[model samples]
Target: MAGLVWKDIIYIKKMWKTMLFAVLFFILFSFSRNDAVSSMALIAIMVGSNFSMIPFNYDNYSKWNEYQYAFPISRKTAVCSRYLFGVIVFGCCALIYALIMMFQLFIINEIPEKEDLLLQIGVVCFVPVMQSILFPLIYHCGVEQARLYFVAIFALIAMLVIGCSSVIVNMFCEENTIMIIAAMIIIPILLYIFSLRLSINIEQKKMA
Candidate 1:
């Protein structure tokens, strides 16, 4: 299981130079904005969302799945490794954002609002939440088609949120805040577990 996870890590290691440039660009761009802290928070979420799905593309390009079954690893381990990889990617991106945030807050003496702090927290969890939505689709549909479906689903959700923005705010008022937070926490865990199981099942039946 560790080896499987390490393999994906190796793939990420190869992209470090490119990712470093992207990080620097995002930081610099954020600093140039009027709302630097908010920009930084959104930059973090963008980075997490974009990079967490790279391994799927890498695996498909290399035909890793077809070859991986020759080894002794179970489908569960393989799927779990991808999920673990997403977490690692999320951690690294969140760390970069945190460091930048700290430097801005303490070093540069920039202060952020409470909402910005909440945004930072959301940035930290964005990738895992995205992975929970995407893994099952990718596992069942393949990377290329999955991207389309993912975008479509994301667009639909975005439109709904925009259309009901006022309602959503009212739904998460002081009285319902705890319930909303609990649902946010619980839904992702349930979805991730379901995605993992569904991915493993799909893998098991892929070439059976």
Candidate 2:
């Protein structure tokens, strides 16, 4: 796992733009009125920003996926690597956001425990769902084409999310927060499973 984590770190270091974007976005969110709003904003970036997506495609340009398939590592490891990359990127954004929040709190002499925790939850919940979409797109179309598709799909999701926010909140806002948390975690795991199956199927066809 250290080796895999190193691979992700090396990949991120080699590709600074995406990391920069996440940092820039974290800075943007720092200006928000509260941690929850700021955190949600960061989560929005995590879900919509595909800076890592290009590098993911680049990784495959050498036929890394094909080569990995030829190696002794299980396909699950290969698939998990891509998923892990998504988490790492999301963690970067979250960490940077937290740092900014820490600085801001120090400067302003205020602490917002509840809002900070909610934002953390939002960041944690958003990444798995975003990766469920991103990996499959990259797997089927490669990075460049997947990027184009990602843009369209991301915009659509943003629109859907915006359009549905009122409905979602109205329906679930007063409901048990535990149920909301459960759904956030469980639904994304289910979706990730579904996406993984689809991605592996696409990869197998490419191999055949």
Candidate 3:
């Protein structure tokens, strides 16, 4: 499993420049001055999370999936590794966004309101939901096929988030921040568990 995760990391390293460019582009686009903080954060999280799929794309391009079966690893391990890889990538993106938010508040003298913070948290929590849908698609359909639908899926999610962020925050936020935070933690774990199971089954079928 560690080797599988490391393999994806190595692929990311090889394409570091492309990843950097994409990140920069997202950051710039998110900071386009017309968007709200929550919208910007959501876009950043989406873009960042999507980067994890690059490894799968590379795998397809190089026929690594076929080659992977030559090793001792099981399809379940391969699927779980991708999920873990996504979690790590998403975590890094979240951390970077947090740091940037802090820098904006402390250095730039721009403080975000409580509502803004809550909305950002809400947006971040939604990332795993997107991943839960996407990973199984990649596993079953192959990355190339999945990539086409990826655009549509992301656009739909972006529309929902951007269009209904206020309503979502209102429904989830209320007066207690703890409840929303708990949902953020719990919901993603549940979704990821389901996603892992689905991906494992799909990979097993592919292997068979």
Candidate 4:
């Protein structure tokens, strides 16, 4: 499983130029706008989650599925590795964005309020939820087919974030800060578990 995760990292490393460009673009955009903290965070999550698909593309190119089964690894392990890789990638991206936000705030001599930080955390949590939707489709339908639907997936995620943000704003009270934080942590985890199971089942069917 570690090797599998490393394999994905290698693929990402090969695309270093593109990744560098993306980071620069986002950084420039972040600095250009006054109200771009949340938007920058959201873009980081989206880009990082998209990076998770690179390994799948590499696998398809190499017919890795046919060969990977020759080893001791199970379909479940293979599927789980993608999720694990995604978590790492998203975590790194989130950290980078958080630092960027901090720098922005520092430059402006502003301290982030607790609620503002919580909102950022909440938005970050949605990355896994988007991945949960994306990974299953890629595993079951093939990456090429899944790529075609990415626009729709992007739209769906946008709608979900908008809806959730509205609800969070309306329902948030000082007392329920902990509750909101708990929900942000818990919901994405539940969704990931469900998605992992579905992905494992799909991979099993493919292997069988």
Q: TM-scores of all models?
A: 0.80, 0.73, 0.90, 0.87
Candidate 3: segments with Cα more than 4 A from true spot: 172-175
Better lDDT candidate (1, 3): 3
Candidate 2 colliding pairs: none
Global lDDT of each candidate: 0.72, 0.64, 0.77, 0.79
List clashing residue pairs in candidate 3: none
lDDT for 34 (candidate 4) = 63
Off by over 4 Å in 1: 35-42, 154-187
What is candidate 1's local distance difference test score?
A: 0.72
| Evaluation by TM-score, superior candidate among 1 and 4 | 4
Instruction: For candidate 1, list the clashing residue pairs, or say none.
Output: none
For residues 69-147, could you state the per-residue lDDT of candidate 4 as single tens digits? 8999988888888999989877877777677677758777677666667767766787788788889999888998888
Q: How close is candidate 4 to the true structure, as a TM-score?
A: 0.87
Best by lDDT: 4
The sequence of per-residue lDDT tens digits that candidate 2 reaches over residues 61-177 is 756655655657666566666666666766665566567667658977767554344445555566667778878888777788877887787677666655665565455545677
TM-score of 1: 0.80
Off by over 4 Å in 2: 1-5, 29-43, 46-51, 63-70, 100-106, 109-120, 163-172
**Candidate 4 displacement at residue 67 in angstroms:** 2.0
Give the candidates in order of TM-score, highest first.
3, 4, 1, 2
